[model samples]
Target chain A: MTERKREILASSQSVLKEKGYAATSVRDIAKALEMEPASLYSHFKNKEDILKITCFDMADKFELAVREVNDIYFNAEEKLRLAIKLHVEILTQNLDSAIIFIRDWRNLTGTALEQFLTKRNAYEKGFREIVQTGIDEGVFNETDKKFAALTILSSVNWIVEWYKVDGKLNAEQIADKLSNFILSGLKKEMI
Target chain B: MTERKREILASSQSVLKEKGYAATSVRDIAKALEMEPASLYSHFKNKEDILKITCFDMADKFELAVREVNDIYFNAEEKLRLAIKLHVEILTQNLDSAIIFIRDWRNLTGTALEQFLTKRNAYEKGFREIVQTGIDEGVFNETDKKFAALTILSSVNWIVEWYKVDGKLNAEQIADKLSNFILSGLKKEMI
Candidate 1:
């Protein structure tokens, strides 16, 4: 919550992304932050602890985005499009945390790992609920909801791998385009 | 590739998927194959070498699948759909190699790594050409070809992460569902 803690978490995410969770150390985070390893210890107990905080922070962000979308009184089709836009915004906006969250969350062990998976499944379930709503209302195609949800999430999750600071499309445009692409797949009737 | 060489590659890919590229050692692969480390070395100089072959072998599978689809003279939409099915079939049918190909390809280095990137670009280009053909023929939406291609590829690629042999959808059903989702994104209009 503090300014310095945010910096440490940000640096940890970056170092974890660059060196990978297995290869990264608190010292690497300290080096990237230009701080003492002891200072990092004061903030986080260990590398796994650092990863735990980072991973949970990412989960919180994803959940928060989903919650924000839920506040809007829109149809399932509009809700999914807006929720996807929010999800992609977080990923492209905070690129480092996005990459580390997707790639290195596996490195978290014990309760941290278990909780992360639980939260992730819940987050994906939110998407699935939307797809089910669409299917029930006949706004979207009546196909396998799990398959549809996974397809949408996978396509968006992959943006972190290919997104660039100066790509052909900005984050908003890319989100719009991606939302269009995904929504087309779910639309009841093709245009 | 010789029978024994193919066996080595197959075991290497499975071990790499299980233990990851960093943790899996030559001894691990040898243990998996019930072969001595020296015998493994006669096939691959080291773990990285084994990884190189496995990655390229997966790439070859991808290229071979695309080639088979190219033999058909369907419209771009149908061509792209069949190509996606073949691609997913290769991934789900050869599950371990598909996971390794997506996850562990980052661990490759040197000329093998460079050549792999080149080949990957060419493989993507193959897909792009199909999309372009569809766009030219007025069968597909005139969107950013790269973004559309990347969307289709990413959705299919992530299947290696969630697809199961005994899951709700069989390989053929999954391939069909995914192809339908993706083609819906590209088609000019509903039939």
Candidate 2:
């Protein structure tokens, strides 16, 4: 992408984060960029086009984060901790796009919506498998793996809603604290 | 509220859940109720008024749930479990209002927004107190109490996004499993 195109996408994400996908218009994105609405058309097709790119880009980052963890040699407990840290880091680093990815993807239509959901489910499935591996290996508790995975993801995914760049804790500190809390829950009692 | 007013609020919540607070119009709420837009004026002053009621009503349910849990004589662990169950039940039962509560509150303006946020923070504070009590009593682990509370609440709150009325687990079962996971994380190791 050109510098101008990247600037437009970033501006669109900021507007979408505040006004949401359903309420945001091409004009609003242009206004955020201080450009004419017609100018946006030269860079992108329309509002949904921008949303699609923003959502997919954020999703790609999450996918890559998990894939990198899976490539490493670690126990499920360590893998889960690293995954949580990477997930939280991605969310905090790209706060605006992360918010759009979580809240506004439902506004995508047709093939775009279908494909987004597919990628999302697969991403969740990947997380679930980590929990399953832990349970199978007797590292984590013998709880419902699906529920455990969803609960863990929900706990971390919600960081986007409340994380502050200027908050007392930076992303790494927040991640460290959160991972400690979550790992305690998933790990079986030590003998 | 009269039967008609109740119907209007319910319809408003449904429409708000779908179109969101920023995009939803009075006419949309009216259309959802199969009534004329002017008729809605008799019940709600405007779209924001409807949103305020929906948000506060949901917030009241949450507040009341925590209060009830606090009133009981159970230990902190059991109290947290029951609180989780009650919260999950409220969200699953009033899915539309809960969705509006979670996703659309940012659109509330002025005093309504301030009041809503106050209630929200207080509600979180109440949950945090439960964890604080646990730690004080040497029950929960000596982790960061605030992070523990936020993690537990976020884990439960995200239920509104994925919970299906006809999903495999009922609200009670979900609460049971989730409370186990959460409490396990919070509780210190038993000798």
Chain A TM-score values for every predicted structure, listed in order: 0.92, 0.96
How well does each candidate superpose onto the true structure, as a TM-score?
0.91, 0.95
Give the winner by lDDT. Answer: 2
For DockQ, the strongest prediction is 2
Q: Give per-residue lDDT, candidate 1, residue A74.
A: 85
What tens-digit string does per-residue lDDT give for candidate 2 at A78-144?
A: 8888898899899999999999998888888899999998888777877887888788889888887
Q: Estimate candidate 2's RMSD in Å.
A: 1.7
Question: Native contacts recovered, in order, as a fraction for each?
Answer: 0.56, 0.76
Q: For each candidate, what's the DockQ?
A: 0.54, 0.70
Model 1, range B1-191, lDDT digits (tens) per residue? Answer: 78988887887888878757765677887888897878887876776877787788889989877766667788897888788888988888889988878877877777888999988887888888899889999988998888888888998898888888888877778778888888876787846
The candidate maximizing TM-score is 2
Off by over 4 Å in 2: none
lDDT of the candidates, in the order given = 0.83, 0.86
Give me candidate 1's TM-score against the actual structure: 0.91
lDDT, candidate 2, at B81: 90
Candidate 2 falls in which docking quality class? Answer: medium
